[model samples]
Target: MSPINFTHILTQAVDELSESESYKGLFHQHTDGNPLPSAHALCNIVELARAIIFPGYFGNSTVNSRTVTYHIGVNVERLFDLLADQIWAGLCFGGDGECNACNEYQREEAAQLAANFISRLPQLRRVLATDVEAAYNGDPAAHSFGEVISCYPAIRAISNYRIAHELLLLGVPLIPRIITEMAHSETGIDIHPGAQIGSYFTIDHGTGVVIGETCIIGNNVKLYQGVTLGAKSFPLDADGKPIKGIPRHPILEDDVIVYSNATILGRITVGRGATVGGNIWVTENVPAGARVVQRR
Candidate 1:
């Protein structure tokens, strides 16, 4: 084609691309003061939370016993500010177009939610400590708590899950999923923020694990790599769209251990002390204390 023809085509393409209908559902228009949630800021927020929850392991390495409280105080304050903004962004993103009353409500709610989340920090730390313990005690190759905190993929993934879960419970949206997905991308472990997990939960090998939304996991449970607790099928509505919020994932009771590559489907309960061995398919309720292994 001639250069003139090429220029004409380029101009036509620009006009076509600029049409609103062409970009519907794809483009997000920026409002004057309503900012969209940022991946960068959320990453920093997660790091800040990690530093506060597990001091000396993340963020400032120079934090000592004498300075720990000061560091935590500063991180908490910073986290609150960052979290409030992100929460507000998330609210505005999920909300209708900005109104004065609505914006004010979102701002105030964001701060309140952020404060509530901060208040839960102590319990989060305590619960995460149990997870650290679980990881250390469950892994024969793990040498120290420090190793688990510093090096284990499970710690990172689980820590993100716990943080996201707390935020989700506090009624913050979008941001929680982003936080967990960040860990999922980095660790190859996908734990939905809606999953209800209990204390002393640990994932061995920590890769290829999928804990679906609506999963209710009890305390002292262990899951190996490649294990999935997923729904067997989705129930659809009259419109043929999958119904939302139905409890479809597996529920694991206390002291249950699911080995690597095991797929436990449906809303069935794996009773307390049950063991589902590696590379198997489980579609039914497992009684308490039963050992489910793959048939040779």
Candidate 2:
């Protein structure tokens, strides 16, 4: 038998991969001296943000009233530094391809965006505190707020979502999606950072939950496992491509409760105090205080 030409095969593979047509519309070409977004750095940013928000529950477990201020100040400073760099990378990523001057402008813009996000951290924490409380009070199994914060996957996922959502609101592109996808990978809860979730949002046994990009969930909403708030259909363009940035997902008003495995789709509204039961598919608007369950 003849020996294989390993070097020739490698050369052929590299040539095929490097072809412009092979990677068209899928490749991100890095400009000289410009950095792309790093998943590891973004992970660190999430961790830092979580620590700052939850204090002793995450990093610096020894934090008390005496050193809480110092710990938070340090974490916020570090978070600002890391977030600024990643936001800069995201801006570069979404900028006009191969433009050097645009990259410099985005760098400054990223810093300002990062600072704006940092300013919102206090409000973010306040909203997340409501989430933690909602999870604890809604679940009988939850022993304490500490248990919910320390042991709940919902808290972890929601914390990342809140952080990512704030960054998205601040107009830092690419990085927010990366941060939320990191949460989605870790916990099976897939929440788009573009979703507008109000305070006191709780997801019980949150695996398999998907909140779509245009979803608007109001305060005190509780979702069980396998619930999906998604779009029913996409409005396409003349070219048959789905039009981007339309209000397609459902809206849940205040104090609504959706049970496990319930799928709510489209731009319909679930009125205040409505309850959607498990394993049901709802595409229309549900009236206030209405109960929707499977017709057995």
Candidate 3:
């Protein structure tokens, strides 16, 4: 080789192997076979769940009452398998421990949990039906139930929450958060899987809505955009660190409606049929049927 070529090659090698330089590791710490979740798949699952819950409204083919049963049966079965795969990915992602067994064994356990969650879909739909009705009746601009069902972010968010909540109840780890987060990104509504909400709930223009963990929302409660049912502040532990798991969020009794931009803090309760006006702040319990509108 020429003198300049040889010198250049030697210098490049020394620079690469220098003390301050290093090689990028090609091996990853995690190489599990579980499918990595795609936001697309979660979105697809949301759409599929909606179609399964209310037949003929979603999906490609036309559905009739006779075909409805078959359609739901098929979708639920597919949903169970697909969701199980995604949930398995989530669990593995979150250090839920390794399965020392063969691939078949892990896949089998996932299938079982997925099947268990799928079987509960009927009950989930029943709760969501009340949500749809509440949204439709509460909004006069809604032309029909079909319009509300077809075109409401609230329905989509609620559907994702119902599905995720069921998984959380079943103690299926990791995947529930991914499922709910997908809805949050799509709908701008943040309802944590740990939040305990009851039937006939509705949220209008639900962007920036924060329903924290331990929040107990009663039946017939409606929340508008920018509403917050959050803890006043996290109380410090004996070590001066934030404590966990006490009831920190506000509770709304039956028939309460909180309008846009209202901030309700702490473990307080707004009593039955109370109307909290827009852009107000609430920290204490509101009595029944009380209309707390903004002054002037």
Estimate the Cα RMSD of every predicted model relative to the unseen true structure.
Answer: 2.1, 1.6, 5.4
Candidate number achieving the greatest lDDT relative to the actual structure: 1
Model 1 residue 197 lDDT?
A: 98
Per-residue error (Å), model 2, residue 52: 0.9
Q: Output the better candidate (2/3) by lDDT.
A: 2
Task: Check candidate 1 and list the clashing pairs.
Answer: none
Considering summed lDDT, which 10 consecutive residues are worst modelled in model 2? 94-103
Deviation from native of the Cα of residue 27 in model 2, angstroms: 1.3
| Superposition error at 162 for model 1 (Å) | 0.6
Best by TM-score: 2
Order of candidates by TM-score, top first?
Answer: 2, 1, 3
Model 3: runs farther than 4 Å from truth?
1-29, 95-106, 238-241
Candidate 3 residue lDDT tens string, 230-253 = 899999989999998788998888
Residue-level lDDT for 220 in candidate 1? 100
* Candidate 3 weakest ten by summed lDDT: 93-102
